[model samples]
Target: MNCGCDEQRRVTVSRRRLLAAGAAGAFAGLAGSQLDTQLAFAADPAYSGDVLVLLSLRGGFDGLSAVVPAGDPAYYAARPTIAVPKAQLIGGGTFFGLHPALAPLLPYWTSGKLAAVHAVGQPAPNRSHFAAMEELERAAPGTSLRTGWLNRMAGSLGADDPFDAVAMGTARPARVLDGPAPYLGLTSIDAFTLTGDDAVKPVAATMAALYQGAPPALARTAGQLTGALARAKALRSAGYTPANGAAYPSTELGAALRDVARLIKTGAGLMTATVDSGDWDMHENLGPAQPGRRMHDQLAQLAAALAAFATDLGPDGLNRVTLVTISEFGRRVAQNGSGGLDHGYGNAMFVLGGGVRGGRVYGSWPGLTAAQLRDGDLAVTTDYRAVIGEILRARCRVGDLAPVFPGVTASSLGLVATR
Candidate 1:
């Protein structure tokens, strides 16, 4: 049942470890009643930025499959068996066409809310998934800083609350949110609660009283837990139904996105959130562009969930939010004997939101001809950090990019409008 990738195997073990740690903190008993400083609440009312959602596509995602280069004859030559036929593509120009499985998102594409940036990746290629992912989250290359880019971004924006930077969906701590900034991790809104916290047991109240006269740090941590528990309780009590008749799929991505929308709509002072989706390591039988197949089904699920998220948010909510997708790396250009691709370099990124200048592909197209390929992989013309840096400045109102991505300049792709 494993993906046969070193990182995939490591991630499974890591998730287990994170789940144990998260459970002990999020579901604390009266004996050790501590929320582990993972939950805090301080909102910078002056802070104004789009609620950035970072979706990590774990395992090497084949960007060539999602954003097909139909106009490139070499693309078909590379993968004749798995290439998305040009006629079945949708919402693309002469050079690029989205995979047919992405039909759900075509409306957003056509309406200028969704866009893709091709040939984007790390500054230099590192094929090892673990190393690449670590570097990807760290983002500050050629520096000894261990802090994650999102944490730096949050710190730069004056984020002091646990709600400010959240790692939603599975209760695992996001590496991208690693640093001094306080953040929360939860599976969903309703599930975010202290263990045995009821009127009968009153664990939360007891914990609050226990830390009443404690020192500043201890008392502050206790207070944060109580406040966050109270807020989560209120949300659970009120309950939620997707707005605008938006029906999110029963999948993890759908639920995670739904909760993200809920947080935004309820004004949770959320600055950034991170979510992960795995199972993209297609080393065999990636399949053709047809329903029930691996690639097609995965893309369809992604499209459907994203479509639901946007529909639920509507225009006003989307205007204040932006979501971007990233992966450690992409797949090789040519299909293998098993009809799959191996690890690769350059990939594609999807940016979706109200401020986005969508309906077109962005980024320099390094032709797929053998001579243009970088070691049989797509050549990276756009740095992934630069793309995000641009979004941070233009849409998120981040005045300085040096703190988050040291030595990197924000891209001038005009991918999004400044707030």
Candidate 2:
């Protein structure tokens, strides 16, 4: 955590901050608005050590499907078409087999940066995508909760560069980061900065004033936008490319991750950054071919971006960082007539870092027999919040899990590689 980079001056005012003013901009049309005055700027901090990178694989991903349970005849019977064969997978095993499509991640699993949780999910079996995603994002295992868990986390992080929490990929905001920490929803790194040579003092003042009368989310958006604009200009001067020989897919997800790598390496005190990948809800033909099927490509790109990121940052970076990937829920065990799988419960969560208790799958594997499926889906043996709670407690040092996840007891899986 020795955070001294080449002398980058105390940030001056700039345009990126104007566009970035909305920490909650992702929810502009969605959820309730934030207070206007919460938009005040913060001074630079002495520490930016611990970082949490959250990747939400939207669409209920298949934990059983992703990490196949080939040993059990029930598994093959459950997924006749989509079930990955034993020999084709990363490693031959009795209980597990990564989709052959996910070969990119094999090295990490072997090197000990990746850890998977089988039969893992939220407490209640929420089938609706909106409901399940909302519960997960809120970090609330129960239905009766509002405000975001990450927001509460921001509340705990105290304050830094309002840029402490960022949603790096989508133009839309994420549910987990719904609380109060100023978070920017970034699609491109270029868009993350300012436009002109100098900081637009007049325009900044005008926009800041206009947003002054607006809601708090708007005001904060204006301020953070301005701050990012400033940093973007400086970052532009750096003109960086992938330094550690980490190759991100030449896809949109790749672009998103590359920016994240740049920000982390360059001393941007980003405490939480969220990235997303979707299309996992495969109700038909979730199979693998040369170019691979939709599931294959999706998993490939996902694993590629992740592997590249870990490589780009190198071993030292991985030591200080923990990357957690989650889905809304899991997919059904039984494949449909369309050759796809339906919505189910109990998926997996992958926690990666040099410190993770790697080389093993965490959580109790509820077998895929008739008795195991919760009303026809994988029965959840582990609560997702328990995993998040452990990270917040150990890595971030934020002990109170109640505010982040209300009503439910946080059962620590201890999957994190805490130094």
Candidate 3:
């Protein structure tokens, strides 16, 4: 009756404010765009590695329900009401099986393109949504650095292009992509255009002329804005079509992933991209592994969109792409009274890419018995940062993981291969 996670979720920048910033080409927005303008002045090193896509599963994800531990009898004992029947599982060997809801991803699982790491979470768990997510993005604990880990990673890699660090699916960047590294946020590719600019009234040109003889700071800002507008126009003129017969679901996530694919194909100098999927905090009515239920429908939607994205990318596109999922924490090991789950720790992460060693779950499995649980939650056997560190080093070609993860060491889970 006395659960600890009762704080209100954090409110970020409003969508209207984000749009206004984009339209006004403010200093921060200009800095994000200046990456493009600054390219002409510096010999930009070409990034010939995998594009890392960070999919944030907002709301505490119930990894236990999704990645069932049929091998352990204690699992069913803990969540009798909401437990996914072992017989109804989709992909698994003898000990573990995935919930039937994720059927769409089974093909990728079978083809060795998808995998999961169980019992993974932060070094320390925080139940509050805002606090946990902030820690997750910041990644560094007990350190003075306040920049997001993704930003640090991008900065370390010498990325300066506006497209290098992208926060797609919304009008503003996610906290994970926050910091000094240049990045842009947009709901979609076409929605990135400047507002109130037409043939008769050229806002970009007008601003350029106004700031021609201005101070250095004002002039640089103007140049960055105009330059970004020109590049955006070129991209719009080129247009895009999803290759390999891939059809996005027209949902927020689908649209966002579509644009990410578009930018990658366009060679927009993208290094890291972030997307968000929420509503995983199912504290009630998380029905069985059947259609029309809460968790079932959510997972299906997620699987469908992800499968489509991978299909559209095809083998070639995926070969240069690495997609990973992360959440603040997992659900309680034992289901709460309302046939739902409460905030806990040690969630599961999915890794999908051409170089992934899939068709099997990775990580040391801490059993579901009460003794094995960590204060009523799944005990974390793997640090989430290490999992990402592995992907960064193997697929993204990040030279050093220390700057991005601080004191954390990269995992040798063989989740991805060094090409």
After TM-score superposition, the amount by which residue 403's alpha carbon in candidate 2 deviates from its true location, in angstroms, is 1.7
Q: Measured by TM-score, how close is model 1 to the native structure? A: 0.90
Per-model RMSD to reference: 5.8, 7.7, 6.5
Q: Which candidate is the best by TM-score?
A: 1
Can you rank all candidates by TM-score, best first? 1, 3, 2
Backbone Cα, N, C clashes tallied per candidate = 1, 31, 0
Looking at model 1, the pairs that clash are 40-162
Candidate 2 per-residue C-alpha lDDT over 1-419 given as tens digits, one digit per residue, 9 for 90 to 100: 21222211112224454345444443221111110001111234433435677777877887775677777888878766767767777744557877777788788888777888888888778889998888788765435667777667766666446453343222336666555556655555554433244354456446556777677757766666556555665777778788778888886567667877787777655666667766677777777433557777778788888889888888888776788888888888888889888888889888887678776678888787899778988888888877877877777666677777776565567777444
Candidate 2 Cα outliers beyond 4 Å, as residue runs: 1-49, 141-144, 164-172, 193-224
The 0-to-1 C-alpha lDDT of every candidate, in the order given, reads: 0.80, 0.67, 0.76
Model 3 stretches astray by more than 4 angstroms: 1-45, 163-172
RMSD of 2: 7.7
Candidate ranking under lDDT, highest first, comes to: 1, 3, 2
lDDT of 3 at 54: 86
Global Cα lDDT for candidate 2 = 0.67
Q: What is the alpha-carbon lDDT for the whole of candidate 3?
A: 0.76
Q: How many backbone clashes does candidate 2 have?
A: 31
TM-score (C-alpha, index-matched) for candidate 2: 0.82
